[model samples]
Target: MSILSLQGVVAGYGSAPILNGLDLALDEGDIGVIVGPNGAGKSTTLKAVFGLLAVSDGCILLRGEDIANRPTESHAGRGLAFVPQEHNVFRTLSVQENLDMGAYVRRGERAALLDRVFEIFPPLKAKRAQPAGELSGGQRQMVAVGRALMSDPSVLLLDEPTAGLSPLYMSELFDRVVAVNRTGVTVALVEQNARQALGIATRGFVLAGGRMRFTGTGAELLADPDVARSFLGG
Candidate 1:
């Protein structure tokens, strides 16, 4: 069964819907990438699923249970985690403290999870005591992702993870994303770097005008002449 599925999801800031009858699905352990032009509802999809926006219509299912219109906190408690594109971390908090905050909803010890987060992002281990704002853009992004991972989520939603990083850092971040997914967490990412994101994705989705234009394996989308010409910049 799919870990998360969106059926006819219609959502937006107010009443003007951004996601027009959007449908998406992801199985456990799959790295799914959503790529499209600006205003195509790539980030909107994640926001809707994360409950950052109200769903005006349709349902969002987590393991087949309807979670549409549920609060964001409730979704987190249900093993769903989201790392948004910006302002994702507490700038003044220490790296370790930021991670600790991510586990606020959990009821048990989180030492092991903390250790694992540091393991996944080794740079964080060395700067655990430093404020998140003192870190470079890439390291801060790592902190944001590590913070979300502290919750030990079953599904992770990332929006524009590599938005403003240098090429080297962008590549490194993608490697870390792959590393995170290797631990059996399903990842659904909305990325601006289409080709690079799709290269690492198990599945790729192309959205246009808030609707799915193409869906296939990453390799298939990369190799298709039409997809390449239109969305992949030829």
Candidate 2:
């Protein structure tokens, strides 16, 4: 069974729906990438699923349970974590402190979780004591993702993770995303770097005008000539 699925999801800022009957799914341990033009509702999908926006219609299922329109705070306990593109980390806090905030809902044995996140982000281990705002953009992005991982989620939602990143950092971040998936976390991410994002995706979705125009394995979508010409900057 799929780990997460959105069926005919309709959501928006006020009354105008940004996601118009949008649908997508991710299997266990899969790296699902959503790519498309600006205003295509790529980021909006993640927002809707993470409860940043209300689902006016349709269903969002997490491991077969209907979770649409649930309170945003309630999502973490249900094994869902979201790392938004902007203002994701607490600037004044130390790296370790930022990560600690992610586990606010947890009880004991937090050390192991810290170790796990540091293991994935070795640079964070060295700068754990430094203010999060002092770090470079890539490191900040890492902190944001690491903070989300502290929740130990089964499904992670990332919106435009590589936005404004240098090419080197973007490539490195993608490597880390693949590594994260290898550890059995189901990932759904919206990326502006379509070609590279799809390269690491197990499943790839091409969204246009708030709807899925194409869905396939990463390799399949990458190889599709039409996908290249229209969206991949052929």
Candidate 3:
């Protein structure tokens, strides 16, 4: 069964709707990528699922349980984590401090949790004492993702994780994401680099105008000429 599923979900800003009956499903241990142009409601989908936006219609389930309209704080303990594209890290805090915040909900085993995150982001381990704002963009992104992982979530929701970074860092970022997936975490990611994102994804979801344009395996969508011409920059 899917770890996360959205069915006919409708949401918007104060009644000005953005998502119109969109549907998506993410399975356990799968890397699902959502890609489309700007205003395609890519980030909005993550927000809606994370309870940042009101759900005007439809259902969002976590392992078959309705999570629609739940509070953001209520989600953390339920094995859900979200890393937004911008302002993801606590700039004022040190690297280690930001990660520590992620584990506040989990009172015990804090030491082991820190070790797990540091292992994944070695650079973060080296710069644990440095202020998060002093780090480069890519490092900050790593901290953002690492903080989310600190919660030990079952399903991770990433919003434009590779938004702005050098190609080197971007490649490394995706590698870490894949590594995380390998360890049994389900991932739903929003990305602008459709080619690279879809390349690693087990499943691809093409969002356009707040609705899904296509749903299939990564290879299948990449092979589709129409998908290539439109979303793949052909």
Top-down lDDT ranking: 1, 2, 3
Instruction: Please report, as a residue range, the 10-residue window in candidate 3 with the lowest summed lDDT.
Output: 104-113
lDDT of 2 by residue, 1-234 (tens): 889999999998898998899989999999999999999999999988988899999999999999988999999999999999999999999999999998876647478888988888999999999999999999999999999988888899999999899999999999999888877899998999999999999999999999999999999999999999999999
User: What is the RMSD, in Å, between candidate 3 and the native fold over all Cα?
Assistant: 0.9
- For model 3, how does the per-residue alpha-carbon lDDT over 117-186 read when each residue is reduced to its tens digit? 8877889999999999999999999999888888889999999999889999999999999988876889
After best superposition, candidate 3 residue 120: deviation in angstroms?
1.2
Candidate 1 residue lDDT tens string, 14-123: 86999999999999999999999999999999999988899999999999999988888898789999999999999999998999998887648589888889888999
TM-scores for all predictions? 0.98, 0.98, 0.98
In model 1, the runs with Cα more than 4 Å from the true position are: none
Give me the overall lDDT of model 1. Answer: 0.93
